[model samples]
Target: MVHGYSGKILWVNLSNGEVKKQSLDMELAYNFLGGEGIASNILFKEVGPETDPLGPENILIFMTGAFVGTNIPCGIKTTVVSKSPLTGIYGESIFSAPLGLDLKYSGYDGLVVKGRAENPAYIWIHNDQVEVKSAKHLWGMDTFETVDAVREELHDKSISVVAIGPAGERLVKIASIISDDSRAAGRCGLGAVMGSKNLKAIACKGTGKIAVSNPERLDELRREALNIALPNTKTLREHGTAAGLIVFEQNGNLPIRNWTRGSFPEAENITGSTMTQKILVGPNPCKTCPIACGRRVRVPSGPYAMEGSGPEYETMAALGSLCYNSNLESIAKANDICNRLGIDTISTGQTIAFAMECYEKGILQDTGGVDLTWGNPDAIVKMCELIGMKQGLGAILGEGVRRASQLIGKGSEKYAIHVKGLEFPEHNPRKFKSMAVAYATSNVGANHNRGSPMLVERNLLSPELPWKEPVDGFLTKDKGRMAKVYQDLCCAVDSLGMCKFMVFWGKLPLKILTEYYGAVTGRALTFEEFMRIGERIWNIQRAFNNRMGITRKDDTLPERFLKESVNEGPAKGQIVELDVMLEEYYRERGLDEDGKPNEGKLRELGLGWVADIIHKK
Candidate 1:
């Protein structure tokens, strides 16, 4: 049995009702680490470019990292990797709670599901017991309702359940996978893939535990990590990610009016402090989460008065200032709706904002009598409901901003804020120049979590890296190197199954993480080796998309960021100078000017086969 791993992988091929467990390969485990790393490796090897994302051939993998189910703090993350129904490229979304821990406990390091079910179905795992149960009764249920129903049927309140709602069941492209009722495997439209498979939920309960090589040293390291992280993460504990709401607005990092405006004057009304003052009931945290950055709240009584999880910073901005809405209660309502309905708030908010802008421009003549007006709180909340249910105009927006604008044609594509096909998150790229490259080059398309430019630009440099100080966001110099370094760092932390917050916000050093890997696996993962693993993992994902024809032309920011500049605020007159940065970025990544990794780069990373595939083709 492998140390720090369950030593098994659960494979369910719904096409034939075959359920088998394979021994976790040491080569795959150690090389990729886990989570995104192993999952992407498996995906690149198994899933083909000709495979339709919504078809049975596309595999959905739920995987955890090496440190999860161990003594490591914030080891609660789970990465869901599949070919995206949204981006049609390298697709991944991460959700945290005890889901990954529960997955590990079920005696599997990963769960790989493929093929469409004959009928509506859900997978239930109990220790070594596994079954694909009929989900006929759960088909149309919302994520929250499905979770409750699964728990009730299993008679195990302790089990973790991840499910989709009306949005996913209807194959809404912006759908998300919701867990713990409110938390989500948000982004990349993986929920739509679940919907296409007629799968509703996955429930798990485990009685086993992972074995670590050096338990005593691991405990000491965990204590040290908590001591260093707790103080810096205090703000997250208090306000969750909402702490950045007002600050981002002031710094011109907040996108308003569908990225048409630089600053939102009404930002303070929905800031983190306001949420804490009015609605924040307590911190909602996952198992072993030292930061406790999750928000739990409730609206005592009113029209928009119900909530289980309050809006985090991204949600707050997406549903708030982006649509000119400052009503905290309404934002919370929309958030709960998105959570229950299993739709990504970032995409939902951006889509709604795009529709509103189109309506303002008269490009959209009608919205089924639903008012697509700016700053209308009632309208914003209604649009969220509409999008989730895919009713009337919601059907168009539910296709995501890219397709929605195309369907709504008449030059509306320019108003759709996206890259490739995935909608942009709440952050503004104009303010942080590195984000221009980060957003452009992200495999999942405009993903902030995958690239982590916001945290890096804030001077959160890894002490293990040579770069000691922050690079200026306005300048193009070193921005390429900055993007490369952070992308690699994010890959390492994500594959380790530890939260990026631990490294970026908590200031946890890379050298410490190297020690954690050695303590758990009895393997010395040196700093150089750790980063190399990250680089190798990154190349794997990039290669996956490259096989599907993504190149430098596709690696670009939205035209708005390049053509238009906000006239007022800290980022005033700042248009992203992408050419110089792109040239520099390509050089730093060892990618060609066409943006594909050269054969030399892939061969050097021990991916000679990937090089053969790319270059030979």
Candidate 2:
């Protein structure tokens, strides 16, 4: 068992308070390849199609890649899989570093939690042993406090704990699973699934070592990754992802005022460059990640006198320009509150921004009848806490923009700005047709990670865009192909435990991937075959959603984006012709009449093995 992993799959039956461990399945390992692929395959087979997302019958799976807990670079990644409380579909959230590695070293490939606990409880995993302990005291704590309390109970500073806060306890649809200070499995309401389980935290410690078949090749790959990390790391180090804000604004891609506009008034001051110059203290890198995109910021002796995580590009757009808040300190404060309380920043900011617009239009009044004017930093700060704590109006806001808008409908649905229940990220689809296609068909709602071709299409380096000589951020055509390529490429990265940023310079081709895979598994396969597995995994997940009743009709952008024109900036008068782009996209993806995958295409991808399972119902 050279490249063979020693970790077992841990299962806990909460209803009976029974815990067991099973040897990891080598066949599943070679087929699914772990992370999203393995998680999706297991969830599809084990969880019934009609199981209620919040019910005890639904499973909560925390999985890691096979490479996790090893010396391999960026292999320390984990995935949380469950039926989403928000979308009510096969769902997952990916996180990196310490938590996954700890679980693996603790002798578990993954942990599957089923049935609700009789009372509040937390699972303690030490080496190969597992126990469900009472967590009545941990229930009321925020994420930061939860970690502190759990560490104290375990009496081991070295143990890694992934826990939820009051938001998860309250079953907020956008609640997060926070781990290792700032790392989070932050999307798709997986935290709410943990809350429904009546499980407070999972703490683990390990004394085992992970092995690789070829140490020399592993060391060689490590050297290559580190060499790439050195000079190339400056992009993330210098500006972080926030570095893209100015580039986004310059290209009219920033989502201003709930995407009613695409440009902001004070984009410069809120850009990443400004944050670095103002309050950035240092770079924060994840475990084994060469590109440290995370930034630590401290605004001592100011209106915001705290030190914590700064606003990444998404936070800056959603909280700053989207809400019209020019104060960077307020944005940083919001990020910290969301992290501490374990909430998704993008959804929180979007909900509040939607509320701000509602207030401006007289749709909502403060319970005390206070006016919520745009750019009111105090009101913004107050609402952030209010949302985190789920207090009064904050409770309604915690349901996310989709539900909140419906609860206070006065034509406000038009401003909710979400696709398939999840709020849109900072990118504006109206400005990039590829993003429009990506947003419409994303398995997890309007997420940018599924296929972020914004940089490619915009040609950030060249003044000219990709399609034509004259750059037009708002134009639409041939973007369907762009979306298709990036989606497959991104899925490959997700499967391999590689950061998507590696593709920024150029794609980390299948040759590079297969070389590494061969080093690990000793399997001789072409890059094409490795990619076929990735494509197969993607289709399997898509088929999972389709099995849950997602149809071609569900693939659509919000009406606001399709109907409303970008009323300001270089992208003025631009509206996403989503239907045209989506139609082209459907064809490009090899889907038929109603956008179901064609048997021919499925066979072409060597996915005909599952065609019967997909088309039977």
Winning model by TM-score: 1
RMSD of 2: 3.0
Query: Per-residue lDDT for 479-576 in model 2, tens only?
Result: 77667766765666576566666435422333555567667766664755665666667777777787787789988998887878876677788778
| lDDT score of residue 325 within candidate 2 | 81
TM-score for each candidate, following the candidate numbering: 0.99, 0.93
Q: Candidate 1 residues 210-329, lDDT tens each?
A: 999999999999888888888988888888888988889888899888888887888999999899999989988877887888888899898898969888999998999999999999
Local error of candidate 1 at 247, Å?
1.1
lDDT for position 452 in model 1: 72
Lowest summed-lDDT stretch of 10 residues in model 2?
Answer: 461-470
Which sections of candidate 2 miss by over 4 Å? 2-7, 301-303, 366-371, 458-475, 502-510, 599-610
| Model 1 misplaced stretches (Cα beyond 4 Å) | none
Model 1 TM: 0.99
